[model samples]
Target: MGRAAAAEALTRVRKTLVSVPNLAKVMANSPALVKGWLALPGALSEGVIPAPVRERLAIATAQYNNCEYCLSAHTYIGAHVAEVDAEELERARDAESFDPHIAALLALSDAIARGRGRIDERQPKARRAAGVADAETAEVAGNLAPNLLADTDNEWPVVTPCTHN
Candidate 1:
């Protein structure tokens, strides 16, 4: 994509996700990565797992990996867009979700973040009992792609404090 088109794409993506999308300012430099970013959310959203579930998993993974930028971004998305509550957000930041279903997904997300996508046996069993399918679990893992990339980027360039405005 040309620079202008890429700029437009970034604007649209940021607008779709956040009003002042701070992370894109750094990430849009890589066009190839943008392509993957474009596809990931849609693919994950298409799965049977709810969008809020994906957000919870993403928040857990971000916090597990100590990515405060992702934690912040996903926290906003989770609360404003996904309608997740303050208690749930705190649970995610603490890596201790009380909701049984979310707790299971958080376990899978934690394992994936720590083990780099290699899940322990017990997590899947818990998810199974929660009626979450393997395919959905895989999608949850995939949904973390943007969070991981954003978190990595956060370590390099200084991302200033952004606002809802």
Candidate 2:
């Protein structure tokens, strides 16, 4: 199939999985997962990290993993929730010529996705320089674990349903 066809197929599947009825049932049974997902947006909103940067990281990671669901979801969230401008979002989607800090965060997220929590020293150091505390970094790492796994498992049929435990 062509790229467009594949993307459309994925989008249809994602929409089905994340439909309100489906997610409502999942959230009702899996409160912990819901909570963790909620915490990610809460942290970003509370300034644990700049929302734009965090969204950029998410988008880059999703793209690297070829997770169509996550890429579309993060792209939407990065623009809507994070208030990232279109130009910056496009830069992140392309993973080129972005801000140094955003680039570093994307690199770190990529490492985490591939290494499964065994990121290089430079990853944490770069996050630190970006004003992300160890605690916050750890939290983000924890949040990313399941996301990466879900993407790998092809469980994300929709925009990745959020969980709030």
Candidate 3:
């Protein structure tokens, strides 16, 4: 079998009785979805965007969409990749305290996930002060699109499941 098919088979076999199918299985059936997932890791690791800020953006997007799977995935990634502790992740999850820049990014991501594509003036200003440039902000906003679109209750596009998020 092909790699994708093999992965899917493995996922299915591993979760014979689980109600929520493994996200890896879901992604294996969809190339575009997998592409988007791959893009996130590469973009976040590029050093232009700080890892904490990226995780906040990701977690905020997932939260706004009410995607439990994405929330869980991003939370773990935040701790692992961003080196953010569980306490910080909890605060971010609760819309409480975090690094100022990370908080602003999360707020911006929340706005986007809620269907407001444009970032507010205050948020951009805060992000700029926090060391994020306009170009970087735009990129962060763009990165959030797939997650936002996927989580829309009204849309529900045929995306592959992402086991990691």
TM-score each candidate: 0.78, 0.59, 0.65
Worst 10 residues of 1 by lDDT: 156-165
Root-mean-square deviation per candidate:
5.7, 10.9, 8.2
- TM-score order, best first, reads 1, 3, 2
Kindly give the number of clashing pairs for every candidate: 0, 8, 5
Model 1: residue 1 alpha-carbon error in angstroms: 8.1
- TM-score of model 1 vs. true structure: 0.78
lDDT of 2 by residue, 39-82 (tens): 55565556555667777777766666666667666778778777
- lDDT (CA) per prediction: 0.69, 0.58, 0.60
Pairs in steric clash, model 2: 14-157, 14-158, 31-165, 34-163, 34-164, 35-163, 35-164, 35-165
Kindly report which residue stretches of model 2 are placed more than 4 angstroms away from their true locations once superposed.
Answer: 1-27, 94-97, 121-136, 139-143, 146-165
Measured by TM-score, how close is model 3 to the native structure?
0.65
Stretches > 4 Å off in candidate 1: 18-20, 149-165
Error of 2 at 84 (Å): 1.5
- Clashing pairs for model 1 are none
lDDT string, candidate 3, 77-103, tens digits: 678767988787766664545576666
How much RMSD separates candidate 3 from the native structure? 8.2
